[model samples]
Target: MNERMIRLADQSGRCDLHTHTQASDGMQPPAENVRLAREKGLAALAITDHDTVAGIAEALEAGKQYGITVVPGVEISTRAGGKDIHVLGYYVDPQHGLFLSRLAELRATRAQRNEAIILKLRNLGIDITLEKVVAGIGRELKPDESIGRPHIADELVRLGAAADMRDAFDKYLADGAAAFVLPPRITPEEACQWIIGAGGAPVLAHPGLYGDDELVRGIVERSAFRGIEVYHSDHGPAEEARYLAMAAEYGLVVTGGSDFHGARQGVIFHGDIGSVTVSVDVLGQLKS
Candidate 1:
């Protein structure tokens, strides 16, 4: 366990391990997310932006300024049994060569997927363009930010084709919807290996959201993941207990986070920083 992380956790009684920033689909920049963690009285915050570590540096800088501990992390999207599975990599080296190369390839794949979705939408007479979608999202797409269906949904809303993001996803962007495009696939095992290779702890993210305890169990049994996210904002009391039991059964580390995405989705689904409680001892257990 890192003594510094242990001390921080001991002081604040809470930490958020899963969070996003504008580097991906989140609404705020990394620094702002760190500042919010400080305001929320959190001892530590992890900037687990989707498939990218571009936000970690800024978050770390902001953490220093705000007196909060920033855990360097990334959320990797992968597939298993045709289902989307997300792996959270904590304590990652952002500059790892192989990791950087894989991220670039994933980003390129994401761009292609976005283009295909737009073409499908146009064929369905939605008449949307990538430029319009970018404009709708109100930000120039950064290299670190992978353009995904959320941005497309934003475009749909801007065009008055849908009332909101959820509506847009329901109508055209969700899996099996008209504009849906299958994402590039990587296995959960491969994802875990990558995280381990990068000298980080790989954790299964939001098992409850995926609706398959068996699949999560299969991954844990077959792969090298070090932890499970036991305290997600979306996890109910029952779900939390279930994962907690699983963690103990597997001898895996326990982690919790708000999955904060800022205001992009309107209401924050996970409670604010201090609200979702995970003890410092659990944070210590995550130390490599």
Candidate 2:
């Protein structure tokens, strides 16, 4: 660890277990995100970009220069009870073919979904185009890699439809928003199995937000995942307490994270890695 990192750890500081970069739905690139993490004095971080490990290599390389350890991770969007749920996978082999194949399929689905969203928005008189979105993305993405809402949000900002990405999500992109379109998704149990099969620990990203403790528990009991996120920026104090207690009672590891997605998600960006205050020891426990 760097001196700044050690100091942050000594201060009862933060460690963000979840984040994204331009390689996924986030606005900032991985290298810039690492610089922000170092500036924020975060000790450890993970780049849990949606359904892909494309950002991990960049994050790991950047972390090395800044004295932070980057967890190889992904945030997979899956379904349960007709609602989308996010599963966080950490310390996985990026080359795991099972994980890679599933992600590839998801990315293809995401592309189809994005195209459909664009068509829907056009029909709704949004005056936006997919070409505009691709242009705003400003990077050459591989054919199989996913370009998501953030790219569209960027296009919206560029087109003067929204002041910023958050505005775009609020007015158009987020669930229930005007441009919202639900994509095909796998069940949470299936997602957890994929993560476990890839030799990673699968943790429920934010169970408190799911609002179905009984159902969530049912899935948890059936899956091989060993943990739940008990602390998060979007979670209330009461919710965190409840999740922590539930995790303890269920013999599940309790984790925390900031869920930072740069400016794309509206909240202020904390460190890309250290916004949750998770101890290194807690991260170590996941290895077992």
Candidate with the greatest TM-score versus the true structure: 1
TM-score of each: 0.92, 0.88
Residue by residue across 1-288, what tens digits does model 1's lDDT show?
A: 642234235437677788888898787889998888788777788899888998988998998999988889999889886688999999889999999899788788888989998999899888799988777767676767777677778778878888987789898988788788888778889989998898889999999988889988998899898999987878887898899899999998988787877654475634555445466566567774
Task: Report clash pairs, candidate 1.
Answer: none
Worst 10 residues of 2 by lDDT: 3-12
Predicted structure with the largest lDDT when compared to the true one: 1
TM-score of 2: 0.88
Clash pairs, candidate 2, are 14-277, 15-274, 15-277, 16-273, 16-274, 16-275, 45-273
Q: How displaced is residue 154 in candidate 2, in Å? A: 2.9
Residue-level lDDT for 31 in candidate 2: 80
lDDT tens digits, residue span 11-81, model 2? 34456788888778777788887777787777678888898898888888999999887888888998887
* lDDT score at residue 213, model 1, on the 0-100 scale: 93
Query: Which ranges of candidate 2 are over 4 A from the true structure?
Result: 1-14, 142-144, 162-167, 264-273
lDDT of each: 0.82, 0.79
> Distance from true position, residue 109, model 1, in Å?
1.3
Lowest summed lDDT across 10 adjacent residues in model 1 is found at 2-11
